[model samples]
Target chain A: AQSVAQPEDQVNVAEGNPLTVKCTYSVSGNPYLFWYVQYPNRGLQFLLKYITGDNLVKGSYGFEAEFNKSQTSFHLKKPSALVSDSALYFCAVRDEYGDSSYKLIFGSGTRLLVRP
Target chain B: SAVISQKPSRDICQRGTSLTIQCQVDSQVTMMFWYRQQPGQSLTLIATANQGSEATYESGFVIDKFPISRPNLTFSTLTVSNMSPEDSSIYLCSGTGHYFDNEQFFGPGTRLTVL
Candidate 1:
């Protein structure tokens, strides 16, 4: 079964420093990875997605992710964290094998805390 | 990206009562899904709402407990049947573009509190 794993429960960083949220996946075939952000009392918002090309996929709100195939990881990163960027992040994956339905398997999620 | 919205942003209902949450998309879509997000947990797929067809529910979920309806390409509904305190969670509706097969956009979600 295709699944996603986010090792960190929470990540704390300074407002001006860089931030990284780790994500790894296990799938049968080529993986379709995605990153989503959730604000308080809001739905999960699509940030970025990696389907075929381009390992470095940039997303909304100045966020980007690197898809490392060898390591089976798609880590979300930002050059400089902002206090408003603090929110919950979820990594999801779907294998491009037999299933054509858009069903996504999500990770446990990581809470981002950016201190001003 | 398609804009999605859910009715009754938050509601408190009694146990055993059922609540039907409506999902309306600004534009037509080919795929619509319902998800549940428990407190302090990740989102879990509840079912896939197919237009003019029975919903395809994920494992550990059934059609009776969470019946879904997709009247058209831009409208869907998820009814939490025989609600209990365990059903108290945020129910979200999401969909992808008609022809685009990239990312799925989500609605604000309906926060249901069963008392």
Candidate 2:
């Protein structure tokens, strides 16, 4: 089974400060982890993914995520937080080898609030 | 990247009525997916829509309650039947990318409010 866990329900960060949203996962095989952001009343937008690559992956809006295989964690990061970055973030995982490869298991989601 | 569009961005229906949501993709895809998100909840996969085959629904979801149709490689529809207050949620549709990794691109989603 492939599952993702986002421990924080909400994270607050001051403007221009670095922010991190924690995510962890469990999968039978190699994990294909993804990060998505959903604004108010909007659909989810893909941020970045970690399939097989460097531990640090950069994404849109100057956002990045660190994939630490040792910790089984893929935490989303931002160098400088902005008010416009406030939104709901979701972490998802997909199994590398399985009949249910197309299916994605999502986390509970984390709300990021950037204070001005 | 795939461009996906959904019809009737939002709707309000009575308890006994049914509503059908349409999803159209600009690019051809082998698999399309339908998801649901209730208020303050994460997205849950409702079913997988594949061309020329019956939609495969996830656990706790039935075909009779949420019938799906994949008429072609680029279009699919999900109809919510016998609606109730519990059915009020945002229904989303997505298409898998052509790449082997199968990244997904999503539609804006349809918000249904059952009264």
Candidate 3:
């Protein structure tokens, strides 16, 4: 079975400061990883995904994630934070084997609070 | 990305009652997924709805408690039967253009509050 872990329950950063939301996963074969953001009372919005290719993947809203195979990590990063960026972020993973199935196993989620 | 809509964006239901959440996509999709997100938690996959076959549920979920229907490629519904306070959560529908890539587009979500 595939699984994801987000060590932080919450992360806080000041506006204009860099921010990182950590994520790690355990899965067999190659792993397909993703990041999503959810605002209060709203559904998840896709941030980015790392299927293959470059370890650095850029995504919407000036967000990016670095996939480190050795660390089994895909940490979301932003050069600078914004108050509007405050929300819950989730990391998800899926095994890319006979499980051609696309079901995603998600992490517990990390709350991001960007103070102004 | 797909344009998805969910009906009855939110509702307060009495315990023991049931509520059916509708999901509609602007374009046809081969597979649709139902997911639940309890307050302050990550999303959990409930089941996968195929156009012509019975929905395949994930572990810890069953068809009896959450019956799913996919009448066609563009529409699906999930009914939360015999509701209880524990069932109160946000239900979301998602779809993907490619099965392998697993890039999902999600609906606005239906919030259920069981009393």
Candidate 4:
């Protein structure tokens, strides 16, 4: 079975400061990880994904994530926080060699609040 | 990246009523998925909408409660039947690009409120 865990329910960051949202996963085989952001009353927007490339992946809105295979973690990071970046963040994982018909498993989600 | 759209951005219905959410993609995709997200919760996969075939539902979900249809590669629908207060959630439709590596794009979503 594949699963994702986001330990923090909320993360607070100051404007112009770096921020990080922690995420870890459990899967049977090699994992495919992704990050998504959601605003109130809106759908989730794709942030970035870790398939099989470099340890760090850059994404939209000046956000990035580092994939650590040994730690089984994919933590979202941003160099400078913006008020507009405040939203809900989700971490998802899928087993690369598991059931071909399976869907992605998502974490409970972490609420990000960027204060000015 | 594929652009996806969903109809009825929001709807309020009484108990025992049903609401159908529509999803349309700008480009044809091999896999169309329906997901449910409760208030302040992460997305939960409801079913995999397979074109020209019956949708494959996830555990704890049933076709009777949430019937799905995939007439083509670019369009699908998910109906929430006999809705209850517990059924109030945001339903999202998602799909992947042609390349396929488990990366998915999502629609804006339809918020359903059952009274």
> CA lDDT, every prediction?
0.94, 0.91, 0.92, 0.92
Q: What CAPRI grade goes to candidate 4?
A: medium
- Docking tier of model 2: it is medium
Clash count per candidate: 0, 0, 0, 0
Q: For candidate 4, write residues A6-74 as lDDT tens digits.
A: 999999999999999999999999998999999988888889999897999999999999999999999
| Model 3 alpha-carbon miss at residue A44, Å | 0.6
The digit string of per-residue lDDT tens for model 4 on B11-46 reads: 999999999999999988888999998878888899
Measured with C-alpha atoms, the lDDT of residue A98 in candidate 3 is 35
User: Scored by Cα lDDT, where does model 2 land?
Assistant: 0.91
Tens-place lDDT digits, model 2, residues A23-96:
99999899888999999888889999998879998989999999999899999999999999999999999888
lDDT of 3: 0.92
Model 3 residue A114 lDDT score: 98
Which candidate order results from sorting by lDDT in descending order?
1, 3, 4, 2
The runs of at least 3 residues in candidate 4 whose Cα sits more than 4 Å from the true structure, single-residue gaps closed, are: none
User: In candidate 4 chain B, what residue range of length 10 has the lowest lDDT sum?
Assistant: B96-105
> What's the DockQ for every one of the candidates?
0.77, 0.72, 0.74, 0.68
Residue-wise C-alpha lDDT for candidate 3, range B4-97, written one tens digit per residue: 9999899999999999999999987777899998877988899999788899998999999999999998899999999999999999999875
Task: Name the runs in model 1 displaced over 4 angstroms.
Answer: none
Evaluation by DockQ, superior candidate among 1 and 3: 1
